[model samples]
Structures are given as structure tokens and as C-alpha cells.
Target chain A: METINYQNFRIEAENICVDYNGKVALYDANLRLKPGQICGLVGMNGAGKTTFFNALTGFVNISKGKIRINGESLRSAQKDQTIAYVPQNEGIDSQFPISVWDVVMMGRYGSMNIFRCPRESDVQAVKDAIERVDLTDHLSTPIGNLSGGQRKRTFLARAIAQRASILLLDEPFSGVDIRTEKLISELFIQFKKEGKTILLSTHDMIHVREFCDLVLLINKTVVAYGETSEVFTPENITTTFGGISPDFLFGPES
Target chain B: MELFSFLNLDTFITDPLTHDFMRKALLMSSLVAAVCGFLSSYLTLKGWALMGDAVSHSVMPGVVVAYALGLPFSLGAFIFGVGSVALIGFIKQKSRVKEDTVIGLVFTGFFALGIVLVSKIKSNIDLHSILFGSPLGISLSDVKQTIFISLLVVILLSIFRKDLMLYCFDPRHAKTVGINVFFLHYLLLTCLSLAAVVGLQSVGIILVVAMLITPGATAYLLTDKFDNMTVISVLSAIISSLIGIYVSFWLDLETGGSIVLAQTFIFLFAFLFAPRYGIFKLQKLFAGYK
Candidate 1:
């Protein structure tokens, strides 16, 4: 619970710099995460947490620095199928045409080669993931029709189905209802317990502090880093929001 | 109706293509219509249909350049069209310029360059067909190109169907899943260019771009589901093609423009009258007007 072997890390970003156009989003951002850990990245808007995520998943071109997964750089981990990224956009409309089974099958695409389609075992993994998410009843329903919580569960199921050692989630908690958020946080913990390394970018300080092992305070630079309890202070929260109350962080009721 | 006897419906539908031109035109337009329907719905959903207009018209310079160089005109047009999408994409990311503004700049610039080239080369070239297509101008070579490219677009798209849809609906999420967002972006652009080029030879740029947009726009009025939108758009396109050809024949008008005109009619009707989703219907409900 206290520490992970730095040598067995699943993801490591060293002196990463990301820019959109000429405007740099992240500068000299360094992060490390071992398997069996959940690392929460917290920041204000334009804080570079998402940009750091963008670097890790190969979304934005690597402007500067290196990202490694499972002890290999993105190039090698990408080749080895040791990682999966859970995009915040994975939510579906209530009327989305695809079934639960089909949506989950997307996970296998990264694992499968271009020449080969998903195998039967791949489909079974999707079904198992759906069942794990407790979406068995709605497996055949269109994903677009699911509730917000269900949609979040569907994406969680997808990441689970990927069965990768590393999971990178971007703003997964935003737009999700509270019950689903709790369930998702627990699942991240479960993924960590199962030795999967999770690097999630979120604005919710309380959850990150409660659930994450280590925290990276990002704002175009590494504002702070280390244990969640140490990284999240009242001043840090106030500074990150730039005087805006952390209402979204605490919950809507607050 | 007795009108069928006077009109020779059997001769038109059953033995419709005694003339090679008619045969090629019908075959080509039908294929073009189907492909346009599929591509349009996806493009519309992703807000890329606007870019479709920009790129298709912007492809003018490429076509003119290719013709000037004596290379395949469509190839130049396609490369430029896809290039424009990539360019716009990067520009959107890199600059603070509004998207519509970028589209307008690129669209007008490329189209102006094309106009200049065509004017310079007007003595030797045929700009009429590229601007306003001759479905009847479809050759056996053109037919092969249309079929091959359309098939390629559909196959590539279908193979990566979910990926394409994911990218379209929410690229913010697509990047999270380890999917190459830019790769997929350009992939769709490439497919769009292929569709445009193939449709150009079979129909022409105006009708090709229209076909790639209107059917999907009309279908959006009918359903919210992505798959349903695709199916509805394709069906609408096929219907428009069949009816447009007949109407043109009956009126002794140009077939390609007639088909586009017919599709526009469909769009208008759908826009006004689609149940629950139509603008007119929504207005009626809102104001409690009959």
C-alpha cells in the first residue's frame, strides 16, 4: 500500500513537453507508475494533466521527452500490446445502435493484428466484461440508450476487457453520476489490486486523494508530486482553480 | 396508370440501357448514389460534412493541375482534397481561427486557384464535366474506377466501421483508447477523397459533393441511431437516383443535375415534414399551431 518497486513500473514519462501549435501545454512533466498502482493526475483547466495523458497514449505527437510502458517506451509497449487507454468519450447515447457485446469487442482490436478479426475468445472476454459490469441484462440493448452510470460502466467494462497492465483514463469521472463514480473508483482500485497500473487524469481532488496511491499536480509543469495526501492541500486546490470554488470536485450538492 | 403505357416504362426500366451511355450513366450513378449515402451520414454526424463541401470544391486546383500536367485528373483532386482535410485539421489544432473561417479560407483559396488554372488552360480543357458532371460521360474505364474506388471506400470503412464512428462521435474518447486519432482522421479524409474522386468520374464534383451531404442530412431527420442514419440515407439516395433519372428522361433534361435537384427536394421535404424531428413539425408543436 505504501510503495511500489520503481524498477517494475508500467508507465514512466520523463521530461515530457507537449505543445498545441506553439503554445506549450506541458513542460518538463515527469511521472512514473508501477503495475499494481493507481496514479491520479489532478490539475485545473489547461493544467497539462490531459496533455500528459495525450503524450502517453500517442494522441499528440511527442514534442519532447519519453514515455515508457511496462519498462518499454511507447514504441515497444505499443508493439507488445501491454497498454490500453480508456477515453472519456467512451459513453454512448441511449439509442446507440451497437450492443454491449459489440462495444466491448472494440477492446480486442488493439490486441488483434490487422489481418485477423476478433476471435471467439475475444468475444467471450467482452461478454465476461459486460457481466462484470453488471450490464448482462442490457447486453443486447443499444449503448446510446443506457443511463449515464451504465455508460460509464460500459467503458469500464471495455478497459477491463482490454486486460492490459496499463490503463490511461481522461476525465472519466466527469458527467458520470455519483453512484457510477463510486463504482468506477472501486473498479480502479480493483484493477490496481489485480496488478494493473492506472494513470487517470481528473479534476476531482477528494476522490483522487481518497482512492489514488500517488498524485501528480499538473499545470503546464509539475506543481507537486508524491503521495495523494501530501500532494492535495487547501492551498494547492485554491491555486489550481485560480479562486473558483472546487464545487465540481466536491460534488454538485456542495 | 395508363400513363405507364404512353411512357414506355418497360422499355426504360427493363431495357433501359440499349445505349452504352445510358447504361454506364445508370450503373455509375446508382453506385455513386449508394456510396454517397453512406459517407454523407457519417460525415454529417461528425460535423465533417461542412468540410466535405470545402474539400470537394477546394479540389478544383488539384483537378486543374492534374489536367495541366496530363496526369489522371482525379488523382490530383483526391490528393489535394485529403490534403486539405489534414491541413484544416492541423490548422484547427494550431491556430485560434474559428473552424468555419478556416474552411472558408481553404475552400475559396483552392477553388480560386483551380479557376485560374482552368482559365489559363480553357483552350484545351473540358471544365464543364468536372464542374457539372455528365453521368452519360461515364466510360467503361470510368465505371471500373468508380466501382473499384467505391468498393475500396466501403470496405475500408466497414472494416473499421466502429473505429470510424467512434472517431466521428467523440474523438476526445477515441484517443484515450490507444486509437491513433490523427491517423483515423486522415483515413476518413482519404476515404472521402476517394469517394469524391470516384463520384466525380461517375457524376461530377457538384453532384458528388451534394450526394455525399444531402442524403445524410435528410436521414438525420429520420433517426438518431448511427446505423439507422446510414441505412436511411442510402435508401433515400437510391430512391432519388431512380426517380431523378426517370424525371430527367421524361423532361428531356440533364441527368446528373436532375438527380441532385431531386435529392435536394428530398432534403427539403425531410427537413420540413419528418415526424417528431422536422423543423416545421417542431415549430407547430412549440406554438401549438396546426
Candidate 2:
């Protein structure tokens, strides 16, 4: 494979392959995301979207691939806090005795001292992130007391506070309210304006069409990827979803 | 009126301190309880109550080995406690068996080995003292050992409280931001082992798990903040230790059993009467709706 100029892209994955105990989860997956692009990762269930995200964050070892974030190795990029990840909502212990402010403050933990005592700048960043998510009223509330949408916003706030150049979100819209959806959409537009790279996985075709400028379809590997207008065709959707053109895609494209 | 005479202020509070052994037991138990209370918050929050039980029981073989080698009992107990944790993790990862099953298997095996060693050996290692504790007969050396271990555990836990909290609460997030999850995992296990060794001196192997669980569980029901939970847990545990020591002295009861009973009673009280999360409060709130 030819070596691409890593400086031109915020995230670069070349022939990424992941194997879980000899079972192939992702194979020969390749993607290059430039700054200021919102790439929608569209795939079916068990299609390795989460696996790809895990690979990017260095959570899972890549069996055969080179991944560079902002022209550096994944570990160096993570150390520099170049990427922020908002994982799906299922794994978090909501009943944990933590406030929304504390959860958001976790975003700044990398910048804090060994004791994690927040500096003035860290506190200000946490406040700004919470404000961006419009969760100021519930800042001090225990995370368990929040509604589902509020809980999603709290994690989003943590990601926003990270102030990283690249953002990776896994199904950020699942099970959230309409108000939260609108709020998140607005944030995405603002994030793009700020020239931050974003890669989000979602099942909602409407959200893909409306918000994503670039679309990458995958079924264990990259099926197609390009500008949304060109790549997000019915054929691509059908191929990605294993031969079924989802009903949502047939809806009038706005 | 005569039934309440045991509660006389001087006889209950002042009499026990006069005896050198009673004073040492009181001080050692309180120190052990305070450290256990502090760790309980993390243990309960991480859902490691069973893990605590496993580590405590696993230390028995180490204690016996240390005795046979003429070594410090805490050293042997600490090694086995940490070893069992690592062994459990290894087995759980290398095989398909669930974590709880692995923990149960490994701890019981180590405990049974300790029992077998006790029967086979001819040393002065009193099985009763090791199992039920010898708080009433605590030596000065035991007092110093408990103080040193408690201070060490308390200092490390205080310094890393927030980092440990983040690790326990959202380890995935902790990893994404560059926190060393593996190091923190082992660090917590090591601290738990240290806490278990300290607990062994006061509550013995059988009841140390209670010292490491009930106070934290009670405080968890009482608060919505980790900081507050630690404080409440420490206070409750210390109070229980002091009260149990006093009552045991006056009533001629087993000291370790009495302390654990005091902890259990407090936990029950919190379960029924905690301001927001209490069972009765939730019941009352539901009744209002009906």
C-alpha cells in the first residue's frame, strides 16, 4: 500500500483488521477523515462499527493496520488529547454517586494534576461544556436522577469539554428525546464550523442525510465511502444492511 | 431500671480503658474499622463485596505459611490476598467461566488449603484466634502493625480517591483520556489486600468482610456523593467499633462478633430510615400517590 500524506487527514486507518480470539470482527477496513468533516459510519448490527471506534481509541489491538491520528501514532495522539470519545450509554453505571458536573469534569482529567484537582481553566471548560449541552440546571444533580436525554447530554458535555480536534461518537442519538436530537444537531454544525473532525455511527438514515457531509458504509469492512450525495445511494444502503433497503431510506430525502 | 444498669457511663466507657489489653484492642479495632470504612465506599460502589470476601478468605493460607516460616502474618496474608485476585483475573480471562464463579472457586480452595495446613502442622498458631480474631488479647506489636497499615492505606486512598472514583465509575472514559486502567486495577487490588490484612487483626478472616462491606453499604444508602459516603462510612464504622468494644467488655461477649453485630444493626437502621433512599421513605412516597 502507498503511504498517504498523514498531515492532510485528522484520522487515517489503512487496512485495519481486528480479530477477537481468531474470529474476524473487522477486516481490511480503511478510512481517511479530513478536518471539518462529519462522516456518518453506517452499518448493520454486528457490523464492527463499535469495533472500528474501539480500534481508533486504542481500546482494541489492531491485528494488521496502521492508524494515525493527526499525523501521530494512536498512543501519542491519545496522550496529546487529540481525540474525544462518547461511548454508547449502556455501560455507564447511572446509579454511581456522581453529579453531572463531576461527569463533565472527567473530560478535563487529562489536563489536571495527578490528584485531579481542577484548575481554574478546567472548571471554566467544564462549565462551558455543560452550558453547550444546555444542562446548567442539572449540573449538581446526581446522574441517576436525570432522564434518558439528560444522561446522554451529560456524556456529550464530557466530550465537548475535552476540546479535542477529533470526536468519535457511537450511536449518540439512540433513545434520546427530540429536543436532545435538535440540540445535538446544532452542536454538530457548530463543531464543523470550528474545523473539528467527527465520526459518528448511527442507524437513523434521516440523521445521516441531514447532518453528515460524508458517509462511510461498512459491513465488516468498508463497503463504500465518499461525499454523502454520491455514496449514500439505495444500492450502498442495501449492500451495507445485507440486501435489505431499509424503509427509512425510501422516505423522501430532504 | 435494673436491666439498664449495664449502660452506666463510668462502668461502660471508663472501665475498659484501664486494662492495658483492653486499651490496645480498642485502639486497634477503631483504627482497623476506620480504614475498612474508607475502603468500603470503593468496594461497594465497584460491586466488589464478594471480591472483598474472597480476598479475606484467601489470606488464611498465607497466614499459615507465614507462621510456619516464622514471618510476619500480615506479610504472608497480603501476598496470598493479592495472589488470589490476580489468579482469579487470569482464570476469568483465559477461560469462559464467569468472574463470580472463578472468585468463589479460588477463594474457597485457598481457604480449605489453609484449614488443612492448620490440621497437619504442630505450631502454636491458634486456629480460633486466626478465625475469630484475638482483639481482646491484642499485643503492642499488633497495635503498631495495625496503625502502620491503616495509615498507609488511608494515605494512598486519600491521594488517589478521585482517580480511583473515575476508574470505577467509567473506566472506558478513563482509558480514552490516557489514565492507565491496568495500573489502577492492580493498585486497587493491592490496596484491598492491605486493607484485608489490617481487618484480619480486628475482625478475623470470617468477619473482616463485614467490616469491609456493611459500613460502606450503609453509607451508600445514606448519601448521593462519594466524598460524603466515605465520611459517613468511616464515622459509622468507628462508632460501631467503639460501641462493640464497650458492650463486649461489659457483657462478656465475643468482641469481633459484637463489632460486626453493631455494624449490621447500623446498616439495618440506615436501610429503613435513610432520608431519601430509605425503604420506608420510598414506601411513604408511593403511599402518597395512591
Candidate 3:
């Protein structure tokens, strides 16, 4: 697979708003993403990164907003299975007594007719995902037994198996070992090369400074949106997290 | 002479009434086992113990309604059970109240209404069958009712097995994968209501809860996979059924009580001694290795 150049909008949000229990979570949040790029959403806790993702994916209702992918609405993308969302945490109960292979196989469900059973191609896709994520060894193991990093990798395997055109990831690097984070970062680069659009949220400065093509910093509002090098200035770092020295962005050692 | 008559083939075989009662009991018991056994796995997975209780108890009003309307009793139980489940789901999702609170609220209110209805029709109706079993009193008509509901339940389950599996395990993920969470949730509740309606006569309210729950919970301790858990649940239910009936026949005990007692034994077995996920298994592993 070859990377497509950034072109027309693959994902767009206009005046998106969401409210939970009468408390506004996200208000008139506007975002746009083009195909074949890796974008990072860097935000403080409760800065509405997840809410925006949920709204774009239709996990929550779109109130007072226009969201579309590839010139079609979010509702239309749902029918086309164009957006594949990987939540902050995987939803399968850890003790559910299911295999790693089975978890990955869940990706194929979107591609299958709901009324019919999953077919052999679905199984093969899952296998390919497992092999790609270097989880061939743990294919038979129950998901509960996996380490935190392995679990994240398994979720990546699910998205890969899904073969979705757009990927929505929420903090994939959280609580993972550096080595595991490195591997996931490499995989995202590979996904970009294959012409898939990725929108991920994170607070990890290293991943942001080195890899992302676009960066959006927020604390309940979009502070900066542009190339990572342009938006990730020393002043911007101190502004996003309160009281942090500009030198802390790279730190004394670096 | 009487003892010899009890032992004689001519006496035993020629008593048509006793033979009929025995056959009816076996058919009815198996039907109860078949439905309750399989349905319990879903109930356990969903953490709806109270909902199951509510469905069973709420159907009391439905039965009363049926008596009042002069319709078939099973139809009444089904309507009330299904309707109440929908109501519970609607309230929980649509309101600020927590789910258990909603279930308790709806079930208690519906059950109270049923009590009032039954009290109104008290003289003409004997609604003991709604609360407890008359297993020895199963009629041919009861068998017909059990068969129809069980068959419908089994067929619907098989058709939706994959969606239901995902729906139970990871509902948000299920939604991501194109399974409508609300639709499947209500569909499963509908199945539970149907099973609850049929299970009323043979297993009674309390025992039906025990049967649907204990077997699946027991199976959870034994297997770490969905397919195996379902299988183990059905197997445990069947074994309990056969032994419960045997124990009842041998000792002249209540059928529902004995079956639940047997299930409790398995629960105790899995609880105390099963491996890996079981308490005993964890203990054994802790003592022996990791």
C-alpha cells in the first residue's frame, strides 16, 4: 500500500457540541482532517479530545454540528464502515474467556452482514492482523493474560484487521513501556504510508515532537493547529500545562 | 398384598392416571431445564440478577390480567414480562435514575399491581403456580405451552448467537462493529421474558432465578471462553435436572427444590474446588506455584 497525498477532507467537524448531565463537555468544537496524514491532538485532562472523537465517530449524537467524511455525512460513513475507532480502553471484558484471535476477529464484524455468520476471510484478516502486530505467539492466549502494552498492540491489530480508511485512536501510548510505544509509533507511520488517515490523542511530548504531521493543543479550546514543529513551540508547551518551564519541553538532559 | 401390588408390572403399568402424571412431569421438567439452562448464561453475563427477578415477579400481574381477560395464562405472563422489561430499559436509559433503582421501582410497582389484580380475582383463581411449582400437577396443556415457548427461544438464540455474544461481551465494541446496542439489549430481554414465562410453572420464581443464575455463574468458574461457558451451563443444567428428578423420586421431595439444591452443589463445587478462576483453583495455584 502506498500513501496518498493530503487532499480533500477525509474528516470534518463544524460547530460540534455535546452535553452530558447538563454539563457541557465540548462546545462548538470544529476540526478538519485530510486523507493520508497523521494528526495528533495534544490536550489537558478533560480538554474534550475524547468527546470530539466520539462526536466524529457518532458514538454520541451530533448536536448543533455538521460532521462529514469524504464529502458524506457521519451517518453515511457509518453505513460505509469508513471510520474505525479505537477507544482509550478496549471494551472486551478482560475475564470474558475469549482468545486474542477472537478479539482481533471482532474487526471483521463491521464488514459482515449482521444477520449472517462470520466467514473464512474474516478469520484470515484477523490472522494477518495478528501477524502484522507481532502477536503470532499470543494468538491463542486469553486477552486477560496480556500485559498493558500487549493489549494496546492487540487493539491496533483489531483496527488493522478492520482495514478501515480512517482510524480514531484515543491515547494509545498511555501506561505503556517505551519499547511498546516505539513499536506502536512505527506501526502508525506504516499506516500513514498506506494512505490511511489517523487522528490520535495523546499527552506524550516525544511522540508529538518527532512523528506527528499536525498538532492541535487544547485545554477546552483549540490553542494551536498546524505542523508539529510550528505548533509545538516552547511557549506553547508551558501554556498547555500550567507552570511548566519552557526548558522542560526538552528538559536539562536533552 | 398392597406392597406386592405396588411392585407388580400389571398394577404399575395398568394405572393410566399415574403413568400419565409421570410422563407429563418428565416432559415438563426437561422443557424447563432446556430453556432455563441456556438462558441463564446470558443473564449471568449481563449482571441482571435483579432484572431476572423482576421479570419473573412482574409476570404475576400479567397472569392476573390473563385471568381477568379470560385469555391463556402464558400469553398474559409473556405480555407483562416483556412489557415491564421494555419499561425498565426505557426508564433506565431515558431518566436520571440508576439502573438497579429503576428495576426495583418498576418491578415492585408492577408486582404490587398484579397483587391487587389477583386479590380482585382471588376467589375464582388459584395463582400459586405463579410463585411456586405444581410439578406433580402438570397437565397436557402445560406441556404444549412449554414446548412452544422453548422452541421459539432456542431458535431465536441460535439465529442471533454471534450478535448476542458480542452484545454481552463488549457492548460498546459491539456498537462499533455495527451491532445496534439498544436493539440487541431489548431482544435479549425479550428472550429472557419468554423463558421466564415458561419457567414459572415447573421451576417457580425463586428456583428459576437460581437455575438461570447458578448454572452460568458456576460455569464461569470452569471455563474462560464464551462457547465453553454456554456448553458447561447447559450441561450443568441437564445434570442437575436428571439428578434432581431422581432424588425427588427416590426420596419423595419437591422437584424444584431438589434441582436447585443440586445446582447449589455444583456452585459449591465450582466455588470451592474448580481450577484457575475458581477460589479453590486460585488457592491451589497460590500454594503450589504462582
TM-score of each: 0.84, 0.93, 0.89
RMSD (Cα, Å) for all candidates, in order, is 4.8, 3.5, 4.0
Give interface RMSD for all predictions: 4.1, 1.2, 2.4
lDDT of 1: 0.75
List of chain B TM-scores, one per candidate = 0.87, 0.95, 0.86
Stretches off by above 4 angstroms in model 2 are: A1-7, A248-254, B1-4, B282-290
Give the per-residue lDDT of model 3 (tens digit) for A123-218.
Answer: 888989999888999998887888878888888888888888899888888877777788888888788778788889887778777778998776
Q: Quick one: best DockQ, which candidate?
A: 2
lDDT of each: 0.75, 0.89, 0.78
Which model, 2 or 3, shows the larger TM-score?
A: 2
lDDT of 2 at A204: 86
Predictions ranked by DockQ, top down? 2, 3, 1
User: What is the overall TM-score of model 2 with all chains considered together?
Assistant: 0.93
Model 1 Cα lDDT, one tens digit per residue, B145-257: 67888898889888777778777755644565456777888788888887788667544676677888889889988775677889999989888887777677656777778
Candidate with better DockQ, 1 vs 2: 2
10 residues in a row with least lDDT, candidate 1 chain A: A89-98
DockQ of 2: 0.66
Best by lDDT: 2
Tell me the tens digit of each residue's lDDT in model 2 across A1-254: 22334349889999999998678999999999987889999998899999999899888889998999877898888777778888777868888999999999999997788999989999999999999999999989999899888999999999889888789999989989999999999999999877888999998888889999899999999999999999998888989988986655467544
Model 1, span A16-98: residue lDDT tens = 89887788888898888777878888887777776777688676777888887766767666555566766665333444446
TM-score of chain A of 2: 0.94
